[model samples]
Target: MKIALIGYGKMGQAIEAIALQRGHEVVLKVSIDNLEDNTIENIRKADVAIEFTGPESAYENILRCIEAGVPVVSGSTGWLDKYEAAKASCTAHNSAMLYASNFSVGVNIFFALNQKLAALMQPHPEYDVKMLEIHHTQKKDAPSGTAITLAEQILEQNKQKTKWVNHDGSNASDLVILSERIDPAPGTHVITYTSAIDDIEIRHTAHNRQGFATGAVLAAEFLQNKKGIFSMSDVLGI
Candidate 1:
């Protein structure tokens, strides 16, 4: 498959390496300085475009790809408020698009485990739930998108908590989400169910960014000739 890459950053380079290893050609690579290279002519030439840009620019990037009649797979986060608009455009143009907060296969499994554990702990009010996520110091979004998705899943299973509170070391009883941005940590998420008896904790730690890059490539491969908005679950059939 011929691929166009938007955002030639660390993730983009990683994805390119894996795509080449998987026998895919990267026809266009757009970086921060190459705004003119992201034109419709450039985008429409590829079989698919994989986007790993920032939240501020992800929505526009996907729209441009759709206008070019190209399919897209985006792993950008914190721009979901504009997702409905993007979905509408894709539908009107009959373009294929897939977006995921975290594209790691392990993270997808962790999502499934979170759902199951949430359901299991729903009736057990004795346990209190909280989540903590740590990422690289350069990560822009607080709490990480994976943490927000996990918190949403927990809320779906347990109706008692209406919202998530980003813990500021305050003594609040609400469902708390704690975020830590440290030196070069790939990603780490810990969800705990605590009570008087014991504490049940589930965590996913990434050794490096290869898993995320691999998953994005898989999504790009799976999204070819497919239509509508999709998630990692759609790719994994979970």
Candidate 2:
């Protein structure tokens, strides 16, 4: 498999290492130092493109990959308002695209568990749910995308949570997603269901970026020879 890496930062480098170990070749690598090389022609050199860029560039990078008729797997966040537009472009071009907030297989499994727990706790209003996410200090987005996804799942199951707040949620209708930035912390997310009696907590803590990189490569492998929008659910069959 030939891979074109659209973002050559830390996460991108991690993905490259995983991809190579899986017997895949990285044909193109685009980074901030060489933005000129991130063209549609260059993107077309590979069978699939893995995008792990910032919010400002993610949409455009995915679109170019779609235009080049290359399957793209995106793990970017904070630019979901334009997600529908990107999907439309992919459909119009008959290309494949996969997007995930956090591509850790453990995180995706945690997502499934979160939804199940939320549903089980729905009828019991005694338990209030709140989340805490810790990431490296260099992470740009507040309340990591994985936290937002978990909050959305909780909101879907529980009627009381109308929205999610990025702090200590005092409002009864808000799901608190407390975000903390610490040095050298790869990632940590905790979902706690609290009540007057007891507390039930589920957590996923990443020691490094290897899990995320591995999952992205797995998504890319699933997307080959496919044409449509996909999620990690399809990759892991969860």
Candidate 3:
């Protein structure tokens, strides 16, 4: 499939390498310096667009793709407040979009495990759940998007947690998500359920960006001829 990379940063470069290795062509690459290359005429040349840009620019980039009728696979985070608007635009334009907090295959599986654990611990309100996520210092979003996904899944199944707070879960109903940004750390997300008797923990660690890049390409492949909004669960069939 022909692909367009909307962001030419580390993640975008990694995705380009994997897409090329898989025999896919990257037709267009848009970076800060090459903003003019992100025009509708240029975007229409590709079957799909993979966006790994930052929060401030993600919405506009995805919107441009949808407007150009190009299927988009976006792994950008912290811009979810505009997700509904993006979905609405997609439906109106009959465009396809697949968005994920973390596109690593392992992270999605770990997400499933977290939901199940939350359900199992739902009836037993004695347990308290908290999450911690660590990423490279260059990462812009705090608590990481993956951590928010994990916390959301847990909150859905475990009624004890009505909300999530950063760094502090002193309140009984609050699910605390601690974040750390250190140099050279790819990413790590850990969830712990603690009770008076014991603690249960589940974690997912990424050694590099390849896993996420692979999954984003896979998502682009899945969305090549599809229409409507989708999540990683739809692409991975989770």
Report the Cα RMSD per candidate: 1.3, 0.7, 0.8
Residue 72 shift from truth in candidate 2, angstroms = 0.3
Better of 1 and 2 by TM-score: 2
RMSD of 2: 0.7
Question: Per-residue lDDT of 1-238 in model 1, one digit per residue for the tens?
Answer: 9999999999999999999999999999999889789898999889999999998999999999999889999988989999999999999999999998899999999999999999999999888888999999999988798999999999998866778888754543467999999978999999999999999999999999999999999999999988888888999999
Off by over 4 Å in 3: none
Query: Considering summed lDDT, which 10 consecutive residues are worst modelled in model 1?
Result: 166-175
TM-scores for candidates 1 onward, in order: 0.97, 0.99, 0.98
**Greater-TM-score candidate between 1 and 3:** 3
Cα lDDT of model 3 by residue, 1-238, tens digit: 9999999999999999999999999999999899988999999999999998999999999999999999999999999999999999999999999999989999999999998998899899888888899999999989788999888888889877788998774698889999998989999999998889999998898999999999999999999999988988988889
Output the worst ten-in-a-row residue range by lDDT, candidate 3. 161-170
Worst 10 residues of 2 by lDDT: 167-176
**Best-fitting candidate, scored by lDDT:** 2
**Candidate 2 lDDT, 1-238, residue by residue in tens:** 9999999999999999999999999999999999999999999999999999999999999999999999999999999999999999999999999999999999999999999999999999999899999999999999999999999999999988899999884689989999999989999999999999999999999999999999999999999989999999999999
lDDT of each: 0.92, 0.96, 0.92
lDDT of 1: 0.92
For model 3, state the Cα shift of residue 132 in Å: 0.3
Q: List the residue pairs that clash in candidate 1.
A: none
